[model samples]
Target: MARLESTLMAFRAKNGFDRGIAAPQIGVQNRFVAIHLVGKHASPQEDALPQAESELFQHELNHLVGILAVNLVSKDLLSADELLNRFPSHVI
Candidate 1:
């Protein structure tokens, strides 16, 4: 799509790197993403879709379940007691 390409170009110009971009919900009610891979990254064959799709699906599913990155902090970053005290268990 022209919009997607222009956006990516603008981002690359502002930043110093070009990366993959995903265009979601292109068609009516289509729950699919169109991915554009840039730079000298892994080839389509090398980059397995099954594993990537699984992880992506899991992340999206987490949003539906209300489990976010902030909740999954490293133990080193915050102790169990500190984490529990800082954020309610139910909120996470």
Candidate 2:
């Protein structure tokens, strides 16, 4: 959770995204990753897990950065169409 959070935080500060992902809600097969997306307007609900404060922040952050990166690339700012086209599959 801590590692994932760190990755999220780095991603957040860059993209300004606001989305939240509910792990239990989606049945990810493992508790390793719970939340999926937390957008800029959404609130961190009380139902959230008891993650380390820093870890939670980081995880959300990662999602934010991811959204921004995808948007930028899709906009032609980056040149990796072939790879992006097969996203959530072709590997990052």
Work out the TM-score per prediction: 0.33, 0.26
Q: Model 2, range 15-66, lDDT digits (tens) per residue?
A: 8753344233233333444344434434576555444544555554554444
Q: Following a full C-alpha superposition, what root-mean-square deviation does model 1 have from the true structure?
A: 8.9
User: Which residue pairs in candidate 1 collide?
Assistant: none
Off by over 4 Å in 2: 18-31, 34-92
Q: For candidate 1, what is the TM-score? A: 0.33
How many angstroms is residue 10 displaced in model 1 relative to the true structure, after the best TM-score fit?
Answer: 1.3
